[model samples]
Every structure is written in structure tokens, then in C-alpha cells.
Target: MKQLIIITFFLMSSVVLVAQPTFDLGIKAGINNSKVTFRASEYNSESIVKAHFGAFGRLGWGRIYVQPEAYFSSKGGEVFEEGTPSERAGRFDYNNIDIPVLLGVKVINGGMANVRVMAGPVFSVMTSNKIDGNDLLNKQYYEDNYFGYQYGIGVDVSNFFIDARMEHGGELYKHPTLDIDGKNQTFMITVGFKIL
Candidate 1:
């Protein structure tokens, strides 16, 4: 019995020592109900659905993990103004391209499931029509180089995951042309296979 106990302990320690660290690579995509909110009395909120696609990777130790991901995102919105500069009603459109680098951590060790939170910086470019030649729609787009912030939470159950994230972009100068930024938030539910 004494010899069996010693051998068992040695095997467990060897397993721990030999279990090399690991990482996962996969894909994520989902829907974003996006809108632009203006600070001016002449404008109202416009919502649009833009698609996103990207790859992700995770690297760390034990149940604690550090994940960094990057993806391409389309964003924009539309609204009808009650009054026109020269007429009765006016129409406006806006579009942008965004790239976000996110850092995340898992808060639960749910065997095959866990909850995660991620945050990072977003780079955005105004990619469409301009209002008053000023791109009032982009009034929020062009002001800063580091145009936005990224933060989100979701659950991962082995082969599936879901989360909602908020981002804030554009400079509220000259025009209150800031996007719901994060308010144009995303709710993503994805199915993936772990590839290392």
C-alpha cells in the first residue's frame, strides 16, 4: 500500500509537469445593431445592421487565459431630418470601417464553459457620403487617430460562444456626431472548433 501511494503521487506530478501549455485558434462573426446619435437638435438616431468577420487566438496558463483578437467590421446608420437647409425634409447616410484589438480574460472555470470580458482600442475610418461637405455624419469619424474603445462580455461553452460589446468613437466637436460608438454594440453568438 505504501509503495502504491508513492507511485500514484509520482504519476500525478509527472502529468502536471508534462502537460504542456496550450492555445486555441478560431473564427467569430455576428450582428451589430448600429446607430449614430447626434448632439444637435436637427438630428435623430439612425440604426443599421453591419456584418463582421475575423480570427482569434488564445494563449495562457491553466484556467486563466489571455486572448487577443482582430477583425474587420462595417458600421454606419441613416436618419431623416425634419427640415432641410433649403426645403422641408433631408436625408443623410454614414458608413465607416473599424478594426479592434481586444484583450480578454475568463472569469469562470466551467469545465467546458466560461464567462469572459474583453476591452481594447479601435481604429475607424469614415468610408462614405458627407453632409454639408463636412461629413457631419463623420463629424465623429475623422477627429482622432485612436478613434474608439472596445469592451465586451460573453460566455463560451466549448464549441459555442455569445457576448455583447460596446464601443465609443468619433470626436464630439463642431457637431455632436458621435456614434453610439459602443452603443452600436454587437451581440455575437458563434460556433467554433478549437484549432491549435
Candidate 2:
């Protein structure tokens, strides 16, 4: 019975040593170019650059992993009236808290570097908004909460990583009395360091 107990203990130890999963906790900051595209032909949209900062945690087994991130982001765009007497332009700015949960696969897993692809859904809650140059626009024209999706590729070398992603979403703003409907599209690039 003593020999059998020793054998079981060794087997369990070996299993534990062989099945180690990876975990990473990190902080990241990035820039994004965002645009709100309107469906009405009379309005033209242009992208605006903004900053985002956040923290992230990743857990993985083998080449498969899940990452969750929370970040503060400012997003919006500039709109121009195409056929107006003065060609009026308006700017829309929104501050938000964004949370994304992603599933990723490491396509190239090496000893020193790795490349991965990830896709996920994101939830955004608007904390505030600033509208300029348009008297008809207000907070009521924008959404307080919205859902979006993100897909991206990343490269990790040692403890540092970089990611490039594209985000798209449903309607972000709709005017109650006008034919104005807008959706958000953004491209983002970020760099991060792993703390764990």
C-alpha cells in the first residue's frame, strides 16, 4: 500500500508539471481613428483621432486563449453638410467605458515570439458627449450604450506586444425629427507590456 501511494503521488506530480497554462496581466494604451458614417447623402463624415488606455488579462491553455480588457476611450467624428450655403461642419465627441472579451488563437507560437488572431464583442457605455457647431444636435441624439465587435491580429515578443484591430458597430446616433442615422467605424493600434 505504501508503494502504491508513492506511485500515485509521482503520477500526480508529473501531470501537474506537464499541464501548465499561461496567464498574463497587462496595461495598454493606444490610439484610434474613428468615424461616424451617416446614411443621409447630404452629410459627409470624416475620421477623428483619439486616445484610449486600459488594462487587460489573458488566460490560455496550449494555443488557445481568452482575453478580457477594460478601457477608457474617446470616440467621435466630424460631419460636414455637403450642399449647404456655408458648408457647415460639426464635431461629435463621446467619452466611453469599453469592455471587450476576446477569444484568440496563437498561430505562431515560438520560444521568444508569438503571433495571434482574435475576435470578440465589445460593450460601450457613454459617460458624456460634446457637440459643436450644430445647434440641432444634443445628447439625446446619441446612444448611451452600444454593442460592437472587434477583430484583430497581434504579435508578442518577450514581454511586449502590439495589436492592430478594426471595430464596427450598429447605429450610434439617430435624430428624432430628421433623417440622420450614424454608425461607428474605427481602426486602432496599441502596445502593451505584460506584468505577469
Candidate 3:
């Protein structure tokens, strides 16, 4: 009788483990509010709002998961100086491809709803950059690539998800002659649907 009970327990545990969900793939798109901040510049900056769209894949084991995403993003800002007739000092336009690999933990699991917190480093490859209607790519004013980080919270409901995140990028480019040092900062909101 004891042997039969032990056998039954093992069978049920194995079935439960096999039934757990482990992987998901999704597409996401959202709005991005971004800005470029100068470390030593005469002008103040303003936020540049744009849109970002991407696809992501997630792998999970128990309550922990790792997610990787690829996205096209637009980021830049406008500069303003004091005592200027025009409030606009100059405008920066940057387009890039970004990848973020995140590590996350599910903090709350409520059947149909789950709350998660995630953070990770990001790598951005620049596609183009312009300053005041001039091309900065050929001038070598900024680096072609940058390193950054993103952290935020997310909610998963049924097959849909919503996330809000903040990102800060490291120095993007360098202009020794012009004495320019700038970084990227952004706040983003995204919605996603699981397709696979």
C-alpha cells in the first residue's frame, strides 16, 4: 500500500511539471519619450517624443525569466539657450536599432494576472544622426554605437502584456574639436500580444 502511494505522488508531480508553460514569443509597439542631455553645453534640452516597435522572446523556468528584444527606435532632443530670440538652439535627430536582454522575476501570480519586474543592459547601433539639418554621421561627431540600461515593471494578463520602462544610455558620440558630450534618456510605454 505504501509503495502504491509513493508511486502515485511521483506520477502527479511529473504531470504538473510537464504542464507548466516555459516559452513565449510576442510582438510589441509603443510610444517613446526621449531626450539628449549634454554634460557640458550652454543650452538646455527638451524631450523628443517618438514611437518604437519591436518583437520579443521570453524563456521561463519557475518564476524567473529572460527576455530578449530587437527594436527600431527614434531618439533625440532640441536645445535652447537663454536670451536667444528663438527658443530653439538646435535640433538633434537620431535613428537607431536597439537590443535589450532582460532578466525578470514574477512578483505576483494571480491566475489571470501576473506582475513582473525586469532590468537589463542594452546595445544600440546607430542608423543615422542629424543636427540642425546637417549630417553628423560623416563628421564623426558621435560614436556609431552605445551602451545603455533599462529597468521597469510589467503586467501580464491572459495573452496580453503591458510594460513601462526607463532607459539611460551611455555617451553616444564624441567631438573633441567641438567639446560635446551627450547621453540619451527615455521613458517608454508598451503593449504586447503573444503570438507563439
Candidate 4:
């Protein structure tokens, strides 16, 4: 009976070791070009370049994985008058804390490199805002919290990884007395190194 128990224990340990899941945690920083679009056609919007820094973690079982990330992002856009090239209308600038939970799949799983695709929902909370050239627009016009979606592709080479993604945010601003509303669209690229 003692010999039988010892053999069973070794078998279980081997199974557990062979089926271990993969996990990695890392820090990342990236740049983004962001813009705000209005529902009204009379207002024209332009993109702005900004920076973001964050930490991310990934857990994987075979080719499927979940990644959760939190980052501080600076985003905004400038408004222009329709049909006017040089006339500056106004600008909206804000900082946000963004959190995204992504589901991803490895399309090409190689020994040293991999290609992946991912999509997920993101939640953002405004930390600060600045409205320029317009007295009618203030901090009150913007929502404190909002939701968005992100989709992207990524490549991993050894311990280094890179990702390119697009984000579309829900309604960010709505005027109290006017029919003006705005949302955010952004393109971002990031590079990171895995610590574990």
C-alpha cells in the first residue's frame, strides 16, 4: 500500500507540471493620436498627439489569453470652423485613467515569436480637463466617467512585445442647453518588456 501511494503521488505531480499555465506581468509606455468628433456637421475636429504609460498582466492557457491593463492617458482634440482653413475654433484637453480587459488569441504561436489579435471593453474616468477658446464649454460639459472599446494586433518576440490598437469612446461631452455632443477616436502603439 505504501509503494502504491508513492507511485500515485509522482504521477499527479508530473501531470500538474506538464499542464502549468503561462503568466506574465510587464510595464509599457506608448503614444497616441486622438480626436474628438461631434454629431453636428458644422464643427470640424482635428487630432492631437499624446502620451500614455501603463502596466499590464497576461494569463494564458494554450493559445488563449486574458490581458488586463491600467494606464494614465492624455487625450484631446481641436475644433475648427467648417470651410475655414486657418480659423481656430476651440480645443478640449483632458487626462484620464483607463482600464481595459482584453481577450486575445495567438494566431501564430512560434517558439520565439508570436502574432496575436485582441479586442475588449475599456472604462475611463476623467481626472482633469481644459477647454480653450470657448467660454460656453466648461468642465461641466464633459462626463466624469465613460466607456469605450479597443481592438488591435500584437507581436511578441522573446521577452519584448509590441501592440497597435484603435479605440473608440462613447459620448464624452454633451452640452446642457445645446445639441452638441462629442466622442473620442484614437490610434495607439506601444512597446513593452515582460518581467516574468
**Most accurate candidate by TM-score:** 4
Error of 1 at 77 (Å): 1.1
Judged by whole-model lDDT over C-alpha atoms, candidate 3 comes out at: 0.85
Model 4: which ten-residue window has the lowest total lDDT? 80-89
lDDT (tens digit, per residue) of candidate 2 on 1-196 = 9999999999997687558878999999999999888888887888999989999999988788999999999888988787664446788889889899999999999957999999999998889888888764566888888899999999999999999999997678978878878888989999999999
Clashes of 4: 0
The lDDT ranking, best first, is 4, 2, 3, 1
Q: What order do candidates take by TM-score, descending?
A: 4, 2, 3, 1
- Candidate 1: worst-modelled 10 consecutive residues by lDDT: 173-182
The alpha-carbon deviation from the true structure for residue 103 of candidate 2, after best TM-score superposition, in angstroms, is 0.9
lDDT of every model, 2 decimals: 0.59, 0.89, 0.85, 0.90
The residue pairs in collision within model 1 are 140-170, 166-182, 167-181, 167-182, 168-182, 180-183
The TM-score values for the models, in the order shown, are: 0.63, 0.86, 0.83, 0.87
- Tens digit of lDDT per residue, candidate 1, span 77-114? 55545354433322333445566667777778676898
Q: Which candidate should be chosen as best, given lDDT against the real structure? A: 4
Question: How many pairs of residues collide in model 1?
Answer: 6
Higher-scoring candidate on lDDT, 1 or 4 = 4
Candidate 3 residue lDDT tens string, 55-160? 9999986778999999999888776554554544677778889999999999997757999999999999999888783232223676799999999999999999
In candidate 2, how many Å is residue 13 off?
Answer: 15
